[model samples]
Structure formats: structure tokens, C-alpha cells
Target: MARIGVLLMAYGTPRSLEDVEAYYTHIRGGRPPSPERVAELQERYRRIGGRSPLFEITLRQAQALEARLARLALGHSFRIRVGMKHSPPFIDEAVAGLLEEGIERLVAIALAPHYSRMSVGAYHAAVREALARRSAALPVAEIRGWGSHPLFVIAVAERLKEALEDLPRQETMVIFTAHSLPARLREEGDPYETELLDSARRVARVLGLDHWRFAYQSASATGEPWLGPDLLEVLEAIARQGEARHVVVCPIGFLADHLEILYDLDVEAREAAEGWGLSFRRTRSLNDDPLLIETLMALVSEALAD
Candidate 1:
């Protein structure tokens, strides 16, 4: 029997001041996001208790996924582990855990659905780098991107339905948002923006919603151009359309509650909505949702079968 190793990966957050500078530098590709910039980013973490729950949340995500896999009964013996791109309980630690459990083959999956060169792609690189460090070439399988997954589409639709249930539905604009990437990425043929749009379109279609738009959020205004029209701009546009008392932002791209969802949408966007006299509501993240785990189980079953 071939042992199957299951891995969940995420873009990690620093746990302490010791990690602040190094983490910032790695993300900036050795150029550094600037000490001031890094300090600003750190304060966001500070505001939320001086540490991020990303690593913790991802660990629970792995736990839930593994439990679901067991219930779903994937015949191959396997162990599930969580790995972070830039922190301890790192990729190599997870890989080592799998090896300890005698998992001979691996299936690497990102908690994120879309494949951006900066996001999911980075996790893939981490796996390869870890393998190189170990002098081992494990037979690996990967799920490139699952934004178009039928279950994911349905999940978004359900989330949107729940939020729109009480809101005065007349002329309420729907804006689906994801984290933004640099403009150069699209010019270089990156599909980040395209993938997000496709997912949003499918989710909207599933809901039979015609009044919908897509926007990018949490973009940096640093010298380089980033993906847009930004969420605030879109919100303002909808407000300007008149009689727009309500706007719903479905975070169709993200699967959990992180900084972008917390500060970006809940804080910054909410402030903008109030300024424009528009009611604001965002779909709750599908954190450890049972159905979400079912979808992951199905995804795992699909990959292992092939």
C-alpha cells in the first residue's frame, strides 16, 4: 500500500519581533518592503494582539481537512500536515512529519483557491526548495487551482444568499473582492486577476445575480501599479449610482479571516461606505465550515484517484 501524504500550505505571518525584518525581506524578494512599511504592517498584527491567527487557523484547517479525509475513507493510508511559507511548523517540518509517518508520496494543496505567482505559486516553490534541502525527490502531486470548483462556486452563492436575505434587494450592487497583485503580473500573462473574475462570474451566475462587479483590495500604492479598480472605488461608484443604500462584498477569493478581511474590508471599506451613506455587509468567511471540509475531501479523493 502506498502511503499518501496530505499537505496544506499558506503564506505565513511572523510570530514575534525577531521574525519581523526577515519575513518582510523574504516577501519583498530580498528588496525589502522598507522598515517603515514593515513597521506599519507589523502594527496591523499588533492591533490584533501582536500575532496573527493565520498559522493557528491553518493548523485547524489541516486538522479539519484530515478528519474529513478519514471520514470520506480515501483508501490510501495518509497523514495530513500544515506548512507555512515563512515560519516554523514550516514546510520542511510538515514534510518531515509525513516521512516519519511513512507517507511515501505527497499531494501538496494550498488553502487558497487561486494561483497567483505571488501566492499559491510561492507555496509550490517552498515545497521544491524543502525537497532540495532534504536531498529527496518525493513523488508529488499538486492541485494547481480550484477557484472554478463547482463546490467552491456553490459555497459563494450560499454565503451571498444568506447576507442578502434581509437587505433591501433593490438595486443593491454586488462586489466580489480578492487581494490584489501588481500590474506587471498580468502583463507577464499571470492569471490572478482572470481567475478571480471567472470565479466571481460563476458564483454570480449560480446566484442568478445580474448586478455584480469585481474589485481588488489590500493593494499597495508603492511606486508600482497594482490591480484595481480598488474596492473602495467600486463601493464609491455604486454609491454614486444613486438609491444604492446597500452593497454586498463577497470575499469569493479568500477561504479564511485574515488581515485583508479584518482591517481591509471590515474597517477601511466600512469607513468608506459610511462616508458615502451606503450600508455595508460582507459575507462571513467559511472558516472550518463542515461543507468546506467536504469539498476538500472530494478534492483529495479526485486527486488520489488519478
Candidate 2:
């Protein structure tokens, strides 16, 4: 019997400081990064323990998801593989491999919770390109968005509660942040920002968080403006208000503890908060959490049933 392939995709990270240049170039659409930009990225990676564990974490997620699928599906055969957008085991490669394995049916799910044409759509395009190149006619089902999945919302809200366990909830302002995209996408009516905010709202509603809000983070340095109010600006504004001294940043958009979380939030954001005399803490990333695994399984089951 032919097996079903579940391709788990994520925004790839550099394996080590040495891969920084290549990773940066890949993100820039093959335009190599300047030496200064390369050095800056290398320093960020160095600060976060000299490398990102994203690939390994994603692999673990795939293994766990495969096991769960096995138990859930019984005699059904399901094989899971990890795909990266900008690193090794690229989406196109993963698609090709699944086709080679005789997987007639595939479910391609982006690790990202929200959908954006620029992000999740790109992964689908990669799969299509690979199939076109191989002259294969495999049927692929894609999970476009699960931002408001109940289990996912609950899991993130639980993490937020854990982060606020000791901090005074009344005094703490909860900021839910997602990676920023080019502002032009807004004009294009990309539903990413809307979907992202909807997810955050669901989690906040679950936790009964009245002081919760949303912001954008990790905007690119492309001169053209990205989404806002940026996370750092939100922190500074809270300081100015002298209304809340404790702030909990929930990275609603990211599923793992990659550079954006490790360096951007832990290091840069922390410093900014300290400078503003505010206590800063970020909710733990849901990396390989059982809840996350369950969420993926739910999505797969739903896709297969449909």
C-alpha cells in the first residue's frame, strides 16, 4: 500500500555561525548579504549559543508527529518529513523525496500558524515546482491556517499563564507579537496580519486577559517600512505611560525558539525593557510540546478526512 506523506515545513535557520552567510543570502532571494549584514547576523547567532536548534527541533516534531499518527491511524501508513524554506532539506527537496517514496497522497502543513501568500504560499509553490520538474502528478493537500485552533490557543495561553505566574497580572501588560512582513503586503490585502491578530485575540479571550495587545517584531532592514507598532516601541510606550512596569511578550507567530525568539526577544528586547525600567519576560516557545503535536495531528486528520 502506498503511504501518505506529511510534510512539516518551517522557516529554516542556520545550522551554525558558518552557515549564516548562506542562510542570509537564501532569505534575500539569492542576493548575497553585505559583509556588515553577515557579521551582524553571525553575532546574533553567536549570542544565542552559536547556532539555532530549529532544524533539530523540527526533526523531533516530525518524529513525534509520525508516532502519534501511527497510533491514531492504526493500519494506515503515514510518513512525516521536515522541510525548510531557506536551508537544507528544502521544501522542493522534501517534495521530491516524498514522490520518490511513492507517496500518492500528501498533506503539506507549514509550521507557521497563520497564513500569508508570501510565507505559506511560497511553500506550496515550491512543492508545485518540484512536481512540475519531476513530471509527477501527486495530489497534495495543504493546511493553510490553524491560527485559532482551540488546542493551539489553549497551549499558548497556558504558557502565558506560566510566564505570569509570579509577575503581578494587574501590573503586567501582555504583548502578543508576530514576525513583521513588508508593509506593501497590507496594501495587497494579505490576510496574514488579520489572521495573526485573530489568533492572539482567541488566546487572550481564553486567558481573560484584559490588558493584552498586539505588535509586530523582527522587521527587515529593507528601508521600506514593515508592520507596526513594533514590539520595542510598544515596550517604550508602556514605560512612558508609567502604567505597567511588568510586561510579558508572547510570540504568537513563532512556533519554536529560533533566532527571532532567542536573540531578538531574549537579548535585544530584554535590554530595551531594562533601559526603560520595565520588567520583561517572554512566554516559552511551544517547541515539540505535546499540545503542538496534537494540534498538528488534528490538522492532518482533518485534511485526510476532507
Candidate 3:
């Protein structure tokens, strides 16, 4: 088989105090972030473990893809490797290795399902930049957004089903939450918010669930209107109504468990839910789910087909 490469990119995480400044600086475009800010961010990572499991999780993902490829006779003709936008294993390195491998074609996928200029577009930028520096032109294809992929829908819906099973059975609302983008991105005609809503509707349909609505999380209110009603506001609205029994949150944006899933949903949102006199619960992250691994392999297969 002719040589090929598969690149997977994600919004990387910091594993330690050793990495915190550099990671944040990369996210901030090399601007110096305050020491206080760095410390706080490190604390967030520390809450989950002494380090971020992103690299480890990503390696596991790569290994799983390799095994699946081998079993299906795909092999490493399409070598799968990971790159992080703001970490040690940067996209440029991943691309350079692929180029060095004498691979003639490439396929790229972002860990995030929904699209946004700020997130997925960043990965696209990495590829474009890498190709520019290379001596050869490579045929590359990227999966735009799998918000509506059949297996993708099934995976998220099943998680929602599990959440529904634990609810109190009457007037429970499934609050669909995803990371927020700046309103400017929306004004620029970025379809992130719209696509997120579309994913939420599809998942709700699959689970036969109604009374569900999308909310934004991980928002920065620094003098800009972010997408809303934010999760807290949604909880406030439910509190005012005083009728709902539970607010089950399902994070459709993130495929793996991370600080946002742990702190935002489990801690911040949970606090709001409890204080507002409503039950709070969030569906588990896909986090290396075997079915999700299959879906990812299918995505790789589709990209290669293209």
C-alpha cells in the first residue's frame, strides 16, 4: 500500500506547573500571562490529577486506531498521530514527521465534533502552515464536522439515555452544554453556535427526549457578549419557574473528560443547580468509549476515501 498519514488535533491541556505558562502563552499567542492567572489554571488541572491526561488519552486514542487499522487490514499505511495546538507535540512536528515518512496523502480530524473558526480552524491553520514550509505538495483532506454522523449521534444519545435513566422521571430537562465562542465569531458568520444547536436537537431526537435546550459553558465575559442563555442562566430560569425536578447536562462539545467537564459541569454548574433548588447531573464524557473509537475509525476511513 502507498504511504499515507492521519493527523488528529485537539485543544491541548497543561500537565504541570512546568507546562502551565507555556501552554497558556501559546493559547494567548505568546503574550505573557500573569503569574496569578497561571497559578489558577494550574489549580484547575491539579483538581483532576497532578497532571493533565490529554497526552496519555491522545496516545491511547492513537494506539486504538492503530489496532483497529491492523485488524481491518488498513495497517499504518495511513499513520495516525496526534498534535496539540498549544502543547509540546505541536501540529507542525506531526506534519513534518508525516512529510518525512514519504507519505503522498493525508487525512486530518479534530477531536471536537462541532466546528468553529477559533477551534477547528486553528487546526486547519496548522496544516496550511506546515504544507507551505514543505518542499512537496501533499493532498490532504479534513473532516469538517461530524455533528450529525450516525455513529456520533448514537454515541451521544446513548449517554443521554443513561442520564435520563437516573432522573426523577417528571419534568426533567436535559440541558445541552458546549464551549462558548465570542459573539464576534458569530457576527463573522461562524456557524459554531448553530451547529451546536443542531447536534443537540439530533441527540434529543435520538433519545426521544423533549424539554431539552442548549446552553453555553466555559464562557469569558470580558466585555463581550458570549453565546447564551449560559448554563447558569438556564438554571436560574428553571429556578424561577420552580417546577423542574432535575437539570441533566450533556456536554456535546467535548469528546473526552477534562477540566471543563470536571470543574465546569461537576463543580460550577453543580453549585448553581443545587443553590437554585434543582437536581444537577451531567452525562459522562465519551472518553475512549469503544463505540466512539469505532466511529473515529470510520471517520478516518471516510477521510481516506475522500
Candidate that scores best on TM-score: 2
After superposition, the stretches of candidate 2 with alpha carbons farther than 4 Å from their true spots are: none
Supply candidate 1's per-residue lDDT for 61: 78
CA-lDDT, candidates in order? 0.82, 0.91, 0.83
Report the Cα RMSD per candidate.
Answer: 2.0, 1.0, 1.6
Candidate 3, residues 1-306: lDDT per residue as tens digits?
868788888878877768889888888888978999888888777766767676778878888877787677764466778888888689999899888888888888899998887889879888889889876587888777888888988999998899889576567988888998787887799989888888898988887776887888998646888887788998999889875878899999988877788887888889989998888888988878877888888987887766
Residue 211 of model 3, lDDT score: 81
- For 1-306, candidate 1 gives per-residue lDDT tens digits of 678889988877787756777887766778767678888887776666666667777878789888777776657676899887776778888887787787778899888899887889888888887778777767888877899999888887888999898876675878899888888998899888888889998988887888778899999777899988899998888788784788999988888887788878887899899899998999988877776777777788888778
Instruction: Give a tens-digit lDDT track for model 2, residues 1-306.
Output: 558999999989888889999999999999998999999899998898999889999999999999999889545698788889999989888988888788878999999999999898998788778789998887789899789999999989999999988988789999999999998989999999999989998998888889977999999888898989899999999999986989999999999999999999999999999999999999999999999999999999888878
Q: Quick one: RMSD of model 1? A: 2.0
Q: What is the TM-score of each candidate against the true structure?
A: 0.92, 0.98, 0.95
Better of 1 and 2 by lDDT: 2
